[model samples]
Target: MKANVWHGKNKLQVDNVPDPTILNPRDAILKITSTAICGSDLHLLDGYVPTMEKGDILGHEFMGEVVELGSAVTNLKIGDRVVVPFTISCGHCLSCEEKLYSLCENSNPNAWMAEKMWGHSPAGIFGYSHLTGGYAGGQAEYVRVPYADVGCFKVPNDMSDDQVLFLSDILPTGWMAAENCSIEPGDVVAIWGCGPVGLFAIQSAFVQGAERVIAIDRFPERLRMAKKLRAETLNYEEVSVLEALKQLTGGRGPDACIDAVGMEAHGVGMVGAYDTIKQAVRMESDRPIALREAMMACRNGGTVSVPGVYGGLIDKVPFGSVMNRSLTIKTGQTHVQRYMQPLLERIQKGEIDTTCIITHHLPLDEAPHGYDLFKNKQDECIKVVLKP
Candidate 1:
């Protein structure tokens, strides 16, 4: 098998690797057909997330056919096409019973390491880092899936891979972010970042009954995509984002603000430079530019929904404003299993076209190039799908 292996920061290579075999009674092996480069993958690529070792396979959003299955996996068999959620969960846990799959206690074998960092362990994530379970990712020709009966969602025969692949991560992530907003009828939602997740957040906000959405980003192509979804656009580079939100909402801030841009957010002027310097000197692990703005821009008593990925401690968070304004903060790794079937139904009904954000397609061998393209936002690329 050939996989995209991580060597070091800013280094990746397509290398031949041993094929995976079923290691657990609930495990299965998938022959990957389609996989994608997610925004969070860049965190590993740039060394933001810790515990990533050399030779680790890198990708989580993937779908494929079951080439083999273990005896305990009664619900699926050979030839079943499935979309595997990035969060690996055991079906019988309390967290799983409560439908908070990402918080499943039995998934991460590296839980103690995570406990040292976050005080508690979340679910193990495929191909993320050693902080999560070091499960091999699906960015290869084939990979093993643990707790297959719970993690793998069988894809309907009628839907295409491009239409369903995102169910593994970003689509459900966007939906969950919007759901966190607790949008009311005729309410306005503001979102930062115009990347894939941000674009989906814009669309999902509309689906959740938001009367209007405001999108913020510096990319013209991404802003255009938001416009296509009928969201008003603001280029953060062109105007004061706080003032713009104030003016747009007629003196009141937006009802909710979504920070879709995670730790690597590009800041402007001294603030941006400060985060850059702090991160470079190991004073901080993440840049909270978007989060700070979201907290400040949200209306009093409103929600601040974060779908973005943050790997470690951040500096200078505006806790004063969040506390003073009584803002409700909601965020987590998406409980993908909770939303997969519902969002798939939406795709089947043609309510959400997941294919609209795909901007580049590459062979699995060219994954290095694909990563470069997405990381740099080159070629107007919004998303990159790799065919294995």
Candidate 2:
């Protein structure tokens, strides 16, 4: 099998690797038909997330036919097309019972590794780093899916893979971001970043009954995409984001703010430089530029929803403002199983255009080029889908 393998910082190669076999009673092997390069994957590519090693498979948003299934997986059989959630969860755990699948205690074999960093471990994610379970990702021609009964969501026969692939990650992530906002009727939501997740956050905010959504980004193409969803746009490079939010909300700030841009936010001026210097010197692992702005821009008593990925320690978080303003902070890896079925219904009803953000398509062999384009935001590329 050929896979996109991580070598080192800014290095990836399409290499042939051994095919996966069922390793657990609940496991299934998928012959990947479609996979995507997620914004979070860039973290691994750039060495933001720790514990990644050479030869690690690198993708999580994927869908395919169940080529083989283990005996314990009774709900699915060969030939069933399904989208696998990135978060690997055992069905019987307390976390799964409570529908917080991402925090499932039984998934991550590398839990202790994560515990050392985060004090608690998250669910195993396909093709993330060793901090999560080191499960081979679906970026290849095939992958082994553990706890298949809980992770695979079978799609309808009529839908294309492109329409359903994001059900595996970003779509649900964006939806969860909006849900975290707890948008009230006629409320305004502000979102930072205009990438795939950010664009979906904009649309999902509308679906959750937000009367107005303000999108912030420096990319004209992404901002235009947000506007297509009826969100007012602000290029952070052109104006003071804090002042703009204040003026846009008539001095009250947005009811909620979503930081869809995670650790790698392109910060402006000295603060950006400070974060870069700190991170480069190994003093900080993430840049919390968007998070700081979100905390400050949110209205008093409002929610700050984070759908972005942060790998490690951050510097200079504005805890004072959050404490003073009584802001509620909600963040986590998306419990994708919780939202997949409902969001799939939205896609079936034509309410969400999942394909609108996809700007490039390439064969799996060209994944290296795709990654470069996406990482640099070249060619107006917001999303890239690879066919394996």
Candidate 3:
């Protein structure tokens, strides 16, 4: 089987790898039909996330036909079309029982690796690094999905793969980010970054009853997409973001601020330069420019919602500002299983269209090109889906 394999920093290749077979009684083999390159994947490609071995498979958002099912998996059958959530969960665990599937204790085989880094471990994610779980991703022609009864969501026969595919990641991530904001009707929400996650965050904010959403980014194409959803956009390069957001909100600041741009955020003055230098030297693991800006621009006693991916240590976080203002912060890897069925119902009801962000579709073999295009923001690429 041909799949996207990670080599090292800024390197990915399509290689012929052995096909996956059922390794657990709860596992199901998926003949992958559609998969997406997520923003988090770019962190791995750029050497931001640690413990990624050479030739590791590199994808997580995917959907396909169930080709074979293990004896213990009774919820699905062969030939059933299904979308697999990125987070691997055992439904019987304490975390899963609370609907926090992303923190399921039983799934991360490499939990100790993560514990050394963050003092705790998260759920195993498909195609993420060894720190999360050394599990192979779904960027291949096929993949083995563990805990199938709890993680796989079957889609309706009439929907196209494009319409349902993002349920595996970004769509739910965006929705969760918005839901964390706890928006009251007519509230003003501000979001940083206009990438796929940010775009969906904008849509989800409106869906959750936010009266106005302000989107911030430097890319015209991304800002244009946000505008199409009626979000007022700001090109961070054109104005002082803090002041601009202040003025836009009548000097009160936005009610809630969403940082959808993760560790690779481009910063402006000396602070950004410091982050770049430290990141290059391995002194810091993430860039927190958007997070800092969001905290600085959020209304006092308001919420700060983070859907961005951050792997490790950050410096100069404004804890003073947070304490002084009494701001509430909520962030996490999305519990995709919790949102999968409801968001799918939204898609089925035509309440949301997830395919609006797709800008490129290529074969599974062209994954290298897809990664380059997505990382470089070339050719106006917002999202890329590979057909295997």
Candidate 4:
């Protein structure tokens, strides 16, 4: 089977790897049909996340047909089309019982490693890194899904793979981000970054009854997409985002602010340059310009929601502003399982369209070029779907 394998920093290759088989009684083998490159994948590709090994498979958002199932799996059978959540969970665990699937205590085979970093282990994620689970990702012809009964959501026959695939991650992530904001009716929301997650955040805010959404990004293409969704956009490169947001919100700032651009945020001045220098010198693990700006730009009592992926320690966050303004902050990896069925129902009901973000589709073999195109923002790439 050909899989996208990670080599080193800024390196990914399509290589022939052995096909996967059921490794546990609750496992199932899936024949992957569609997979996507996530913005978070760039963190791994750029050597931001640690505990990665060479030859690791690199994808998380994917959906496909079940080819085989282990003896204990009963919820699904052969030939069932399903979209698996990125977070691997055991249904009966405390976190899983509470519907916090991403924080499941039993999924990560490498819990100890994560414990060393964060004092606890979260769920193992597909194709993330050894820190998450060391599980091979779905960016291949086939993948082995563990805890199959709990993780795989059966896709309705009427829906196309493209329609439900993002339920595996970003769609749910965006929804969860918005939900965390607790938007009241007629509230104004400001989102940083117009990437897929940010765009989805905009849509989700509206779904949650936000009256206005302001999307900030430097890319005209991305900002244009936000406009199509009825969001006001700000080009951070062309204008002072904080000032413009203040003006637009009548000096109150947005009722809620979202930081959708995580570790790789770009700013127009010395702050961005300083972060770059710190990241280059290993003095800071992530760039927090977007997060800092979000904190500072939020209304005095507003919420700050973050769906962006940040892997490590950040430098120079404005804690004073966060505390002085009595801001509320919420963020985490999406509990994909919790939102999978709900978001799928929305898709089925014509409430939202998830396919608009797909800007490129390619065979699995061209994954290297796909990564380059997405990372460089080349050809206005917003998302890439890989078919195996």
Worst lDDT 10-window in candidate 2: 266-275
Q: Write the per-residue lDDT of candidate 3 for residues 137-213, one digit (tens) a residue.
A: 99999999999988889999999999999999999999999999999998999999999999999999999999999
**Candidate 3: residue 143 Cα off by (Å):** 0.1
lDDT by candidate, in order shown: 0.90, 0.90, 0.90, 0.88
Q: What is the lDDT of candidate 3?
A: 0.90
Candidate 1 vs candidate 3: which has greater lDDT? Answer: 1
Could you give candidate 1's per-residue lDDT for residues 26-104 as a string of tens digits?
A: 9999999999999989888987765788999999999999999999999998999999999999979999999999999
- TM-score of each model, in listed order: 0.95, 0.95, 0.95, 0.95
> Tens-digit lDDT track for model 4 on 89-187?
998999999999999999999898777666688999999988899999999999999999998899889889889899999999899999999999999
Every candidate's CA RMSD: 3.8, 3.7, 3.6, 3.8
Q: After superposing candidate 2, which stretches have Cα over 4 Å from the reference? A: 266-288
> Using lDDT as the measure, what is the rank order of every candidate, best first?
1, 2, 3, 4
* Segments in model 3 whose C-alpha atoms lie over 4 Å from true places: 266-288
After superposing candidate 1, which stretches have Cα over 4 Å from the reference?
266-288
